[model samples]
Structure formats: C-alpha cells, structure tokens
Target: MTDLERDHSEPPDCLSIVSQVTNSTRAGKRERLAGAAVRVLHEQGVEKTTLADIARAADVPVGNVYYYFKTKDQLIEAAIEAHGHHLQTMLDELGRLAEPQDRLKALLRGWIGERDLTAQYGCPTGTLASELDKRDDGLDRAIAKVMGRLLAWVEEQFAAMGRTDAKELAVALFASYQGVALLTNTFRDPDLMATEGARLERWIDSLT
Candidate 1:
C-alpha cells in the first residue's frame, strides 16, 4: 500500500493527511455556515430563522449541518462571536481618537450610520435577543455578553470624562440612543437619528 493509504489505515493521529483533510473540511464548512447565519439573521429575525433555512442558505445538506453544528444554539453562538469580533475591530479604530468625547461621538455616529444601512433589516443581536428571550437561555446569555462589551466600552469613555458613576451614565446613554433608533425604525423616518444624534452631540459637548 502507498504511504498515504498506510497513514489512513493507522489509528487517529494529528499529523495524518486524512486528519488534516478532515480538519480543513470542517473549518471551511464552519466558515460557510457562519456566513449563512449572518445573512439570514440580518435579513430575518432569529424567531423566523431555522436550521433548514441556514442549510439551504449555505447550500449545504441539512444533515451535513449536523456534522459541524450539533445544535442551532451553537450556530447562533458562533454568529454572535463573529459579530463581536467585528464590533471589537470598530472599537479598536475608535480608540485611536485622541479626545475621549471624540471617541465616544465617533462610536455613536458610526453605529447610527450602520443602522441606517440596515434600517429595514433591523439590528442583528437586538433582534436575536428579542426573539430568543426565554426561549433559549444560552442564546440570551451570548447576546448579553456581546452587548455588555459595548456597554463597558461606553462606560470606560464616561469614566475618562471624570464621571463618578460611569456605568450608570453609559446605560443611560445607551438607553437614549436605542430609544431613538427604535422610534426611527418604527416610523420609517431616517432623519430621526440624524436630528436626535445632533442633539446628543450637543449634550456630550456640555459634559466637558
């Protein structure tokens, strides 16, 4: 038998060519599956999404999906992780801003701009959190963890402004902005964000 066939006949080993191929295939499938989830989650709320939907969206067999993700919750967690990484990259860029308030303002403005792009589609994690509430505790926790990172970053910025209760202030700011975006989306009026955002900018200016 050839060396390749000999390696395959042997017991499981990390260095085996067959093992390497299996790992590569698994990784590629995961990447495609994650991409499908992102697209569907952005276009449709989690409540409206299903494993079959993801499988079809990914152009993979339904049973094939089980080979990679044992449960829908696992897929959702992976999608959330991908989004968290993306948001972290955005935060890293914003962190480079010299002024604290400037960093905060840029962060807020960037979020609003992103919402405008998907105003019709709705926020990814926001929609998932709303739909998965009480339905899947694990998914709820995952979404909360991602949102907590954003909240923590905001609080850090407020603390830089010398606020004694930075966490509370950050929560208030997030609440206000979420309300504005929710109202804007509900009314189908994009200007609501721009108008209210300017007011928020003025308020932040007064802080320093």
Candidate 2:
C-alpha cells in the first residue's frame, strides 16, 4: 500500500490482517476491504451496507469479504479504527498551534472544512455511533473511546484556561457539534455548518 493508505490506528506492524489465513497478498486485500468498508458504510449506512456491497466496491469477489470480515460488524470495527487514525492525525496537526484555544477553534474549523461531506453523510463518527446505538450493538463503546479522546482533549484546553468546569464544558461543546451535525445532515444544508462553526468560535472565545 502507498503511504497515503498505510497509516492506521495501530502501528503498521500491529495492524491485524482480517483474513485468518495469512498470505503474501492478504494484507493488501484487507487494507482494500477496510478502506472500502469505511466509504460504503459512510455512504450506505450500517443497515443498508453489506459485505457483498463492500466487496463489489472494492472490486474483490463477494466471497472475499467473508474471508476478510466474517461479519459486517468486524468491517465496521475496522472502519472505526481507520477513522480514529484520521482523527488523531488531525488532532496532532492542530496541536501544533501555540495556543490551546486556537487549537480548539481549529478543530471546529476542521469540521467546517468538511461541510459538504457532513451535509451528505453527517458526522461520520456521530452517524456511525448513532446507527450502531439503534441496533443495540456493543460497537458504540468503541466509538465512545474515539469521542472521549476529543472530549478529553477539549477538556484539557478548558482546564488549562483555568475553568474548574472543564469536563462539563467539554461535553457541552461536543454535544453542540453532534446536534449541529444532525441538523446539517437532516436538512442537507451546508449553511448550518458555517453558522454553527461561527457560533462555536464565539463560544470558544468566551472560554476565558
């Protein structure tokens, strides 16, 4: 795989190839499957997405999906992991800002940058967790950890700003993002992202 495709939540050495019967080529196949899973799941959602659909999208045989992912849930987990890697990469980039408040605002702006995609598919993480929650699957916990990383990062910023209520503030901030994302998707309005992002920046400035 190319450098563009190789980064994962776990170290490359530690990433598990989904197919139990490891072969020279299976690793590449697994990567393709995981990438395809993320895209298909985002576009099609959990209920409508199927292993066969992912396989077709990947240009692999339908049976190969079973070889890579015994169940759709396993594929979902891989997609979540891939998303975690992407989120952490973004957070790391934002962390380079000299000010914590700037970092927080940058994160919100980053979401705003995806306004088009968010309008089409919603917040990828939020939508995945919500759909999984409706199904009563345990996968929501995995998403919780992904979200917790963001909340904890945000809380750290608030705490650094000397807010004793940092944790509550973080939750409120995240809840706003979730709500905005829902409305943005439901109404298919990119303007909601711009409006909410502006409002969020104002709130961030008030964090002092």
Which candidate leads in lDDT? 2
Model 2: residue 13 alpha-carbon error in angstroms: 8.6
TM-score for candidate 2: 0.85
Q: Write the per-residue lDDT of candidate 1 for residues 1-208, one digit (tens) a residue.
A: 2464454323233344655466644445565777789878877777788888998988888888776677788888778887888889989999999888999899778767866743566566666666777683578888888889988999999999999988888998877777776677677777777787778888888888
Give the per-residue lDDT digits (tens) of candidate 2, residues 1-208: 3563454433242446543245554556666777888888888898998788888887789986666566778778888888888888988898899888898899899899999999999998889888888767778888888988978989998888889999999999889998999999999998999898999999999766
Question: What's the CA RMSD of model 1 in angstroms?
Answer: 5.6
Give the Å error, residue 50, model 2: 1.2
Single out the weakest 10-residue window by summed lDDT for candidate 1: 7-16
In order, what lDDT does every prediction score?
Answer: 0.76, 0.83
Clashes of each: 0, 0
- Write down the TM-score of every candidate: 0.81, 0.85
Candidate 1 Cα outliers beyond 4 Å, as residue runs: 1-27
lDDT of 2 at 21: 44
